[model samples]
Every structure is written in C-alpha cells, then in structure tokens.
Target: MPDLAARLRIEFHWRGGPDVVFADITEWWRDPVVLRDLPPALTALVPGPVPTVVLGPASRGTLLGALIAAHLGVGLVEVRKNDRMALHSPFHIARDLPAGYHEGGARLSFRRALVRPDDRVLCVDDWVESGGQALAIQDMVAEIGAAWLGLACVVDDLGDRAEVRARLGVRALLTAEALQAD
Candidate 1:
C-alpha cells in the first residue's frame, strides 16, 4: 500500500485559545481506492484477533469502529453520546470532556447488551487526546468485567503518549508531528 500518512493534508483550526493543526484525511478518503484500503491498512496495526467486539464512541469513532469491526469479523458496539436509542441497563460516565466535545460536559453510555462480563473488546477511534473518555471507557469495561485488548486510532494528537499507553495500549496510524504543516 502507499504511504497514507504522507498523502493527508493539514489545516489550521482555531479552538479558542490557540490554533490547532489537524490532519485532514477527509479529502484523501474521498478517493474510492483509498477508502477501500483503510481497513487493510488499519488491520495491520493490530497484534492479533483477541477482541470479540469493537467498541467506539459516537460520531467519528463509531464510523471507524464499524469498519474495523467488519475487517476483524467481530461485533460492533457503539458507546452513545446521546439518548437517541432506548437504552436497557446502560453504563454511563459523565465528565468534563476536551474542547471539541460538549462544552460543559458530556455523558457517555455503553449499553448492557453490547458489553458483557466475558467480552474481550478493542476500542477504536478517529483520535485520542487527554484520554479522559478512553479512561472512562476503561473504567466501564472493568466494571463490566470485560477485557480491553487495546486502542487504535487514525491519529494521536495527545502529547502524553506514555500516559495513554499506561492506561491502555494504543496504536495510532499517524501522530500529530506527522500532521504538521510544511
């Protein structure tokens, strides 16, 4: 496969305090070939097939998680950010999320049906930063008596790599350094 990282464009986004550089893969993903190849490229990152389910939060994470789960031939479970679905015995975590998330705070929920005591899950997302949500997910997984195989992301913008790894093993396709503008 081609060097996908090098093909991405970078855009500067202002998030109140400072300008944040974002790796814009949306355009590159528009290409049918590239979109088709995403699953294979991401599958290469996983160590092995240890997870019975792939868990992703709403929005971007949910989209990518579905792809990864399909590639791995596992069940895809969504952690909802809203009460859109009628939940049955859901596990919830309310906390101060990062800037891009809900302003004051966000409530994250995982349905009891998707998460089981014996499940071995893989967490997938578009990006991971601050790791607040991921940590909360980890806590919920533990409470459910489930195992976390690892976390995979399209990008790693968060600087504290060690801290994130300490909490949950992570594999990122691209780092913020690689996404910086020329």
Candidate 2:
C-alpha cells in the first residue's frame, strides 16, 4: 500500500462524517501537500500497463482524474451524474456508485466518438466507499469491449482491497486514509 492510500483510508474512516466524506476526500486533493503526494501514490498502486479513464461527477472528481491522467500521460473519461444534450450518441451504461443514490439505475455517457475499441481504460475517482459507481464505469468499459485496466481513487474506506478488486475486476488504488490513531 502506498503512504497516500494509507492516509486516505485513515481520513475517510476516521475524520470524515457520513454526509461529508465524499466532499472531504475531494477537497483534500486541492491541498498542495496532498496534491503533490497523489501521483506517486497512484503510480505505486496500479498493477499493470492498462491506460486510464477518469470517472467524475461533474465538478467533483474531474480535476483529480485530470491531474492523474496528465501525470501518467493518459486520457481522461468523464462519467456524468446528469444527462447532457451534447452527448446524444454517448455510449451509455448503468453503474451503482458507493455514495450515489439508486441501486443500479445510474448511467454513464461519453462523447460518441471519444473512445476507440482498442482502448484500455483505468477508471479514476475521488473516492471509493461502496464501489457502486466504480462498478458502473467498469460495466461501461465492458460494454465498449475496452480492456478494463483498474480502478483508482483518492480515498478507500472499505479497507478490503481484495474484495474491491474481485468485484470490479481491477485493483483499487487509494491516495489517503481519513482515520487517525490516538
């Protein structure tokens, strides 16, 4: 586990509140110390050579994913929470994210001609608490027949990386832990 992952896990598990952990984790990325520490931490967690696509909720996870993509020299993909008219022909797939509402009705859309068939996608997010949203992005990648590289987050409170990997069929990378020891 990378040091950032440990820190994120601690932060999400300890300092974050029920309604606020998602925002808290996202906000942490804005801090210079945390931002500086993220890329290396993410690089340490990924297990293989698949490229990345970031799954963000409009304003939430976009910057983090974009930064990581820039650092790794890869592309970024957005998973929108609401539908947009411009994405008329986007490839649609349903996902159930951790903190998002609904069991499985959440949908993800990309610009129609954005991704190629041969693209291998690593899904990035700001946090992975329930794995639902990540799973949804994974489903979208599968629908496009793109190789599902892996899932990376700025925080992971679930603790069990194995289960997350098993469910999403990709290793989960977290940058920090919200929990702290006294």
Candidate 3:
C-alpha cells in the first residue's frame, strides 16, 4: 500500500466551484486502508501527554474518536450536537456555539462522568475549520475538571486563526489546502 496522503488524495474530492465548494470525505471512511491507519495517524498528531480519554463531537467525530480511543486503549466521551440528550448525571456539561462551520449556532454537551478531574482529554474529529466546536469541547473538559491535551483531525482548515491553533495545539494529517490541490 502507498502512503496515507497519496491514498487520501486519490479518494478525496471537492464538489462545486466558483461559488460554493464542498469537501467530501465520506469515501475516506469506506476505504479499509484509511480505517485501519487513521487512528495511529491521528494519535501521532498530539503534541502533549497521552490522553486518558478522547472527546469526540457528534456524528463523524464519534466514529473517529472511537477508533482512536480503542487504538490508544483509552475511553471515549461523545459530545452531542444541538441535542440535550446526555447520560443521566448532574455533572453534565454543555456549551453553546454562537457560530459554526455548518450550524449558525449549536449546543454541544456530554456526560460529566465519562471525563474526570484526573483524566486527560484529546478531542478527535474529521475536520477542524472554525475551532468553535473545539473550544466548546475545551470548555466541557474544564467543567468536568479534566485536563485538555489537544485536538487531532483529518483536515485542518483553520485559516489564520493562529491563537486558536496554538491554544488547541491542533494537528492534522492533511491541510485543507492539500485536498484542494488537484
């Protein structure tokens, strides 16, 4: 098998054009090579301590987080999107996003039990663009009294948000620019 970057480029596609460009990553999840390699690749992106648990946003992030958590022999906490559903606990934490990449504003919440004060957390996701969700996760981590390690993603398109990037210690397998290169 070739390198992951080469495989990603081969399978990834950008739909539409001059006005709206949509980045399609569904194909990446279908490929066995990508599924098996993504966990380790994402793990390497961390620039801090080994996380005791992984916090993944709803949907795609949940899948990616599960894989990474399993690979690292850790636990996973799924942060729901715009959903109040959470594990029955008084310690549940939620953060509201004023703006997001897709949703104008959303709520992200998770059970406080999954993450503890002693646990170190790493947020895993398919992509990180605006950093809105990541910041929310960071807040949840704090509310749970857990230590925030960093964030790992498949694509990092945060533009010039140096402060967010530095604060999150964001790392990625490919830059959004890489996917756009044809």
Q: What TM-score would each prediction reach against the true structure?
A: 0.79, 0.70, 0.93
lDDT of 1 by residue, 9-37 (tens): 33222233356533445564456654566
Show where candidate 3 strays beyond 4 Å.
86-89, 99-101
What are the per-residue Cα lDDT tens digits for candidate 2 across 1-182? 43655555444433457765323454465456667787666656777774745445445567777777788787776667656543454345444344335444555555534556688776766666666667766776777778876766655645566676576644445433434331
Better of 1 and 2 by lDDT: 1
Across 1-182, the per-residue lDDT of candidate 3 in tens digits comes to: 77998888888888888999898888998999999999999998787689999989989999999999999999988989867464344667888887645748887888767788999999999989989999989987887688888899999999889899999889999988877775
Q: Which candidate gets the maximum lDDT versus the true structure?
A: 3
TM-score of 1: 0.79
What RMSD does model 2 have?
4.6
Worst 10 residues of 1 by lDDT: 8-17
Judge candidate 3 against the unseen true structure and give its global Cα lDDT, from 0 to 1. Answer: 0.87
Report each candidate's C-alpha RMSD, comma-separated, in the order given: 3.7, 4.6, 2.0
Report the number of clashing residue pairs per model.
0, 22, 0
Give the Cα lDDT of each candidate.
0.70, 0.60, 0.87
- Candidate whose TM-score is highest: 3
